[model samples]
Target: MKTLAIVGAGPGLGLSLAKTFGQHDFRVALIARNQEKLDTYMQQLREMHVEAAGFSADVLHTAQLEAALARVKETFGPVDVLEYSPTPSITDVASVLDVAPENAQFQFDYIVRGALAGVRAVLPDMLAKGDGGLIFTMGGASITPTPMMGNVGIAMAGLRNYVSNLHEVLKPKGIYAGTMSVMGWFKNTDETPARIAASIYEMYEQREQGEHVFEV
Candidate 1:
């Protein structure tokens, strides 16, 4: 079975992604910072008869993140799909006027550098196979800047740009790269995590390139 590795996995979209792909016969490898939560997530997935495992690693620490991905490959073969979407702590966020150098660096490391590490860890295998998917998720601030999300927006915008370019460059090589830019989370609408995950799966199946936006 193919493997889907979700970096920065959490209870929200991460679990949805796992279920969506696992149902389709993709063994799921979830990477996060907390092993306890990871165990809970794995048990939930097992209850649903999905082949899933979890690895604990912090995105800010690229070494641990890369090692986690390496473990995923060792356990489930090479990762056929890599989804990098780690949620940043609210404390790390700051407005444009108030954003500090430390905050900016933290966001950059969490968002942009973390993604690069993930790709570097998995892309080689994907390229050798000539078939794989690289999916990235970011907030709407990445597309349309919000002053309140200044530091995060900066890193997110860079991520979008990087993924966009990667999509174009990898298109001819029989690989898929795309970005999902969500503007906001509307609680009482059709924009649930499962729905968004289904959409992402659809995009992966279609091998669509560039960005897919989910607006309010």
Candidate 2:
């Protein structure tokens, strides 16, 4: 069976994605910083009879992330699908002049550095397999920059570029990489967890060479 490794597993998109893929018979490996939440999510997956495992690691910590990914590979084989979806915080939303230098640094470290770290860690295996999917959860701010959300927007823009570049570099190798931009509010809409999960699955299922942008 195909395996999926989802980083930044949370209450919304992460958990929903897990359930969606699990229902479709994909073995799932979930990663998050909170052990408790991971355990809770695993239990929920079990209720659906999904083969699931959890790993705890802050994406900002490269060593921890590496260890976690190693464990995932050992358990589920080379990951067929990878989802990167770290939730950005208010610290990640600061303007250059409004926040302390250290705070801005932290935001940059997590928003940009953490994501690149994940891509670096996973891309080699995907390239070797010559068939894999890297899906990044992107925000509208990437397309329309907001000064109030300065740092986060800038970091997301960088991620978008990274995804596009990766697509160019890896498509020839049969590794499909792309970013899914959530252009609308996810809360209180018909665009619920199920809808988003279906969209992601559809993208993964119908991925084409050089397809790098999925705006939803």
Candidate 3:
């Protein structure tokens, strides 16, 4: 069976992505840092009759993340699709001036670095196969910077640029790279997650070249 590896399998969009792909008969390999939480989620997938497993790993550390990916491959087969959607704590920014230089690196680490690690983990196999999907769940701050989210805005702006450029570079190599930019608050409603997941699958099927914006 084919595999869909979600690097940040949490209760919201991550789990939604799991089920969305799983419904289409994709075996799921969920990756996250919390074993207990992931185990719960894995059980839920089984209850739904989806072939699934969970692996614990932190994206900040390359070794741990790569190891988890290796195990996923060993268990379910090479990951046909990779979703990177790690949520980071946002530091409020009242103004553009409020964003400190020292804090910039931390923001970059949260979004850019984490997403790249997941891509790097699976890209080689995708390239070898001559096909794969890599999707990032970014947000509105990356699209239109506002005073309230100045800090996160600037940081996500960097991530937005990186994902866009990477998409261009990877597309020719038969890898579809894209980001789903959410512009509004994500409520924990069943419809929203399912809708977003279905949209993501559509984007992948279309091999979208850049960010797919979801505005309020």
Among the numbered candidates, top TM-score falls to 1
lDDT of 1 by residue, 142-206 (tens): 98979999899999999999998999999999999999998886442234888889989999999
Candidate 2 residue pairs in backbone clash: none
**Best to worst by TM-score, what's the order?**
1, 3, 2
- Clashing residue pairs found in predicted model 3: none
Model 3 stretches with alpha carbons more than 4 Å out: 91-95
Give the clashing pairs for model 1. none
Which numbered prediction scores highest in lDDT against the true structure?
Answer: 1
> Which of the two candidates, 1 or 3, achieves a greater lDDT against the reference?
1
lDDT of 2: 0.80
| Runs off by more than 4 Å, candidate 1 | 186-191
Q: How good is model 1 by TM-score?
A: 0.96
lDDT of 2 at 126: 85
The ten-residue window of minimal lDDT in model 2 covers: 207-216
TM-score of each: 0.96, 0.90, 0.92
Model 1, C-alpha of 50: deviation from truth (Å): 0.5
True-vs-predicted CA distance for residue 191, candidate 3, Å:
2.2
